[model samples]
Target: MIQRRQGGFTLIEVLIALLVLAIGLLGMASLSMTSLQSNQGAYLRGQASMLAYDYVERMRGNSAQALLATSPYVISLTSGSTRNNPDCRTKTVGCSASELANQDIFDWWGNLQAAIPGSGVTVTKANTNEYQVVISWTESDAQQHSTGSQTQNFTLRVNL
Candidate 1:
């Protein structure tokens, strides 16, 4: 008597194949998520860097105020609630150096908040004509598994 051979994969073979495919799919998904998070972190860092550079340039423009020890250029991370006089955005003819600095800080802080939530900026005087711009932001998702803290800081030092 001749026995007919099975023409398809066995149940065990099918199950093994499915398990392998599932693992591959899961790995792809995990890689995609990690790539997305990394991209977002990079984007945030770029924004922070640009903001710091922009502020530094503004300080350079107002070198007189920037060099002053009591100038707004030497500021801590505050809520930036000071209303700018003469509305620097519209009238740039007679705004004082301090007013321009205030306007710059206000606009920069606003942009920082809008671009990255929970972001803060601190400008510190390092020397007579040198300053450091420290930009801090929370990377809650990217650094969730890290040790210490989830906050990231970017510092840019400039000289007027």
Candidate 2:
């Protein structure tokens, strides 16, 4: 009688193949999770950029107050700070430049809080017509397994 070799994979071979497949699947899953986290971080960064730009534009629109000796737009706000919306929005005749500046700050802070909680903002006059805007927030990073959150900052300098 002639001995013939088996054509199919052995049990051990099948088990090894399954193990490799499972490892590959787990790697893919981990990769997907990392991608999602990166995307979320990018999204938060984008939001911060937009918020900074919006605040800059608000200052640019009210350049007179923004460049005043005591500018209302020049402010430093801590996290979770609240501002009362001025009566300018309700008045039909509109409001003064200072009032508008106050309203702008109120609206911007409200929007910022809504978009990113626990965010802090600062706007400082750098020159006669230049200003620096800084927005900061904390983000929990996936890679930081123990030390906790990382702080992110978005800074923009504008000439109005």
* 1-160: candidate 2 lDDT, tens digit per residue: 9999878988999999999999999999978877887788898889999999999899889988888877888899989677878979689998988889999999899999889889999889877888899999998777864547899899998888
Count clashing residue pairs per candidate: 0, 0
Tens digits of lDDT, candidate 1, 1-160: 9999878988999999999999999989878877888898899999999888888888888888888878787877744434444477678476778887888777777788888777777888878988888988877464454433377899998778
Best by lDDT: 2
Those runs of model 2 whose alpha carbons end farther than 4 Å from true positions after fitting are 2-7, 143-147
lDDT of each: 0.80, 0.88
lDDT of 2 at 147: 45
> In candidate 2, how many Å is residue 138 off?
1.8
TM-score for each candidate, following the candidate numbering:
0.85, 0.87
Q: What is the lDDT of residue 65 in candidate 2?
A: 87
lDDT score, candidate 2: 0.88
